[model samples]
Target chain A: MAPTLCELCKTTRALIVRPKNHQKLCKSCFISIFETEIHNTITSNSLFFPGERVAIGASGGKDSTVLASVLKTLNERHHYGLNLILLSIDEGIKGYRDDSLKTVKRNAKQYDMPLEIVGYDELYGWTMDQVVEQIGKKGNCTYCGVFRRQALDRGAARLDIKHVVTGHNADDTAETVMMNLLRGDLPRLARATSIVTASAASDIKRSKPLKYAYEKEIVYYALHKGLDYFTTECIYSPEAFRGSARTLIKNLEKVRPSAILDVVKSGEDMARLVPDEVSAAGQGGKDVLVVEGEAYRAGGCGSANGRSSGGEMADTERQLLESEKAQGNETEISHLGQKHDRNCKIPNRTLRKLPKQQMGKCVRCGYLSSQDICKACMLLEGLNKNRPKTQIQVSVDEEDNSSRLTRRMESLKIIPAEQM
Target chain B: MSTQSNEAGMVLLEVEFTGGLELLFSNQRKHKISLPGSDEKGQPATAAFLVRYLCENLMKDTRKEMFVMDGTVRPGILVLINDADWELEGGDLYELKENDNFFFISTLHGG
Candidate 1:
């Protein structure tokens, strides 16, 4: 308990040294105000959606593992009213994903939540190794990112989920802001500007519950909980550019301890809030409810280029009608065949006739289908259009054909009928 | 000594990846840093590079903001600088001057 001769008193600014990169705070300061900000961030924003299914995309790493672990804790203590579920997407990389997958599974078991794991190999018919072979490393992030995003959306849709929660933290957000700014990606900048507001307008309404949480706090939480997790990193991520940003932040913290937080705040500030004028696209501008007609409501705010010049678009039939009404000009609006009535009540017996074959079972996704295949398979196949030109086994189980009839009686989670 | 500014304040910060959620940080002059995780040494290229960038960008005169590496694949690994999490508060914005200390750590997910 001997006091250092150079130590400063509580009131002495002269004794204070700017904390270095690795130093979080002084011992006395650590006890005073560590997690106060995090508490304020969550309570202030009401981050969690009420009585809705929240799927945490768990990667089993410190980031995602920490996220899932803390979310479960907070949900219980705070009663966030979330129907939480664990979602793990396996990109099917060899050395990288194998061990990490184990951690995700272990975490799922510990959390006592039902987990839905969608594998890229099975769903998209392509793995990272296969992707690397096809396009090389030169822009694989584009492919992986797109495919991964679509897959998450497709999976969430199949599960009837309203929101997808990710484990992105402040550092992640800041680096992204920098990367986006560097690349001049205005669309993404305009899209992701919202921290916890209007989360529904985006494709899947991804929320970063860890938006304000720090990596340090997350680690402390895990360590304090003695949570067993996979500590290794993805096998193929060494050459990524995000590595560069992490380095920059460290050096800056030496001089300005608040650099990382400043960067993160800047990113948060950069996000554009959705204006109330463009608000009609309610329900995140997406009526994911399978209630019919409502599906077309999704794209009203998708993009300016896609909409008709007159702010009206119609089918060829509608086109024919419009031409007939106004021969000289193409200004007439046509609303025929619009799918806006998706919610119109249709009794089970009145549903569209399944092309007899669609009543069969799909080889992929194990769902019943009106087209001999299931929607997941159709989408997965479409996504794999450029699937590595490698040889595919194309294996189909012998029992599948015979069991297809029996699939009707079985209550498999996904219905087999697929969209083209 | 007169009221001269502390010039040796430069920490020559370096963060090393020890293992998952574990990192080690030390100025070039320190023989050893007791930070937990891996028994690693010789600044990781990404960690060192980031520290350098932060230094120049933040207009820092010293390497006081050096952060160790937590096991993250991407470059944005969170470092505990001055006990204030770089991931939480203004990460690089955390100021550093003479006598100031820092720590680095990564995010955690609940079980």
Candidate 2:
């Protein structure tokens, strides 16, 4: 076969066939176009303002490495005047996170960005290794996921940064959409598809600048540019239901490369169909369920807002209640009627009947929580009370049983039912 | 064109794996392999044939499913032939050439 020229340059040898548009490009052309597309995503979405402080969620993996490289390049090239920082959550896994965090440290030096790492031990009083020991590795992901979500926010707060950008690409977003759809969590589907999500308090905003980028391009960009990145799966989270969805997405991409971005677009479009009342309830302090593997590292992190469902509504609803109080008796009666309508729809199993979640402060950490204590705090309380009598009881012998543990985790049926 | 005679006409090729797929191949990223110029059916060896050859001959890991699925390289794995996408090169049907570089990168790993 003869060599083909890059479509963009029309001179250099084509080295890449882009999945999104199927355009062939040379190495230089592909790099420039990849960076340019990311620049466009940032600028068009107004993802950043000049002089804004943004934290890059550095996982030391290929996606986050590419994200840091591209963001740094774009910031300097376009004169965005942004202060970029690398924030990593250390789950305290002995071999897995310890190895990856080393790459992240190298990435920080390579990219010339300041780095901040928050560990599960410091934040939640239990390392993942310890949690797995206590819980037998069957459901430790839940503890890790919940802790990492807050750890990121707390890390950003310590840095006084208002926003954190992650490396979630089109593939991750599409997987989340599929996971939510399969679970029949429409409200979460709405939140997951949104480009940006703010906590109920609206303090820190989380965005995925690579939300539209393909994972293939990310790995290619890292390789062509010679960026140092890690490439190991979390040893503890090798197999989960999300892994099945991930495999399905990959298989689909093999048949049709466009399927990944198509699923993303479909998710975004479907998000609009969710009733306003449902989205409102989602926004007003409901605890959004966290997707395993999405939180600190690759876990979906439950829609990026970090709220749970079915909690007492906090300030937002109290404001509504007070406003109703000021209105005439008839308006007050109608507000109550509206509440009854939503509550009664639960029996009918309708989508609009969102569990009324109230935003409140964690009694322990004062971080926002729908419950009196946040998930991390609650998990910590359980671990602290059940602290193993003998230290380091996490048997090394259990290492051989991880596959069995994953199978047990799958059978745990923790996946919320369609109706919840 | 006897099958035994084809062994004398082996072609040299370079194979590299990245994005954690190298773990399946004795944790070695690069291999210089010599292959029969043609398969048993007397046709030029294709990428599909190279995949099977690598698994059976070079791969030391017992977990073959991690690299190959349904008799092909797993779906998330990308194959590049001499720096161009194998998809642009007829994918599994692209015939192996002497000294050609085959790069397989897995996007299935965590990021």
The fnat of each candidate, in order, is 0.24, 0.78
Global fold similarity of model 1 (TM-score): 0.51
Please estimate how well model 1 matches the true structure, expressed as its whole-model Cα lDDT.
Answer: 0.45
lDDT, candidate 2, B1-111, per-residue tens: 222213478878999999999999988999999988787687878889899999899998999999999989998898999988887788888888778899999988887
CAPRI accuracy category, model 2: medium
Kindly list the per-residue Cα lDDT of model 2 for residues A1-420, writing each as its tens digit.
578889988999898998866788999999998898788777766789989999999999998999999999999999999999999999999889999999999999999999999998888777899888887767666666667778889999999999999998889888988977776555566677666777573378999888878999998898899999888888886537778889889889888777887677556545544443444454554433323211111112112222232222222222222322333343223323434333222222212222456777889999876658765666676788884233321211101112222232243333232333
Q: TM-scores, in order shown?
A: 0.51, 0.80
Q: Give the Å error, residue A183, model 1.
A: 2.2
What is the RMSD of candidate 1?
A: 16.6
Top TM-score model: 2
Q: What are the Cα lDDT values of the candidates?
A: 0.45, 0.73
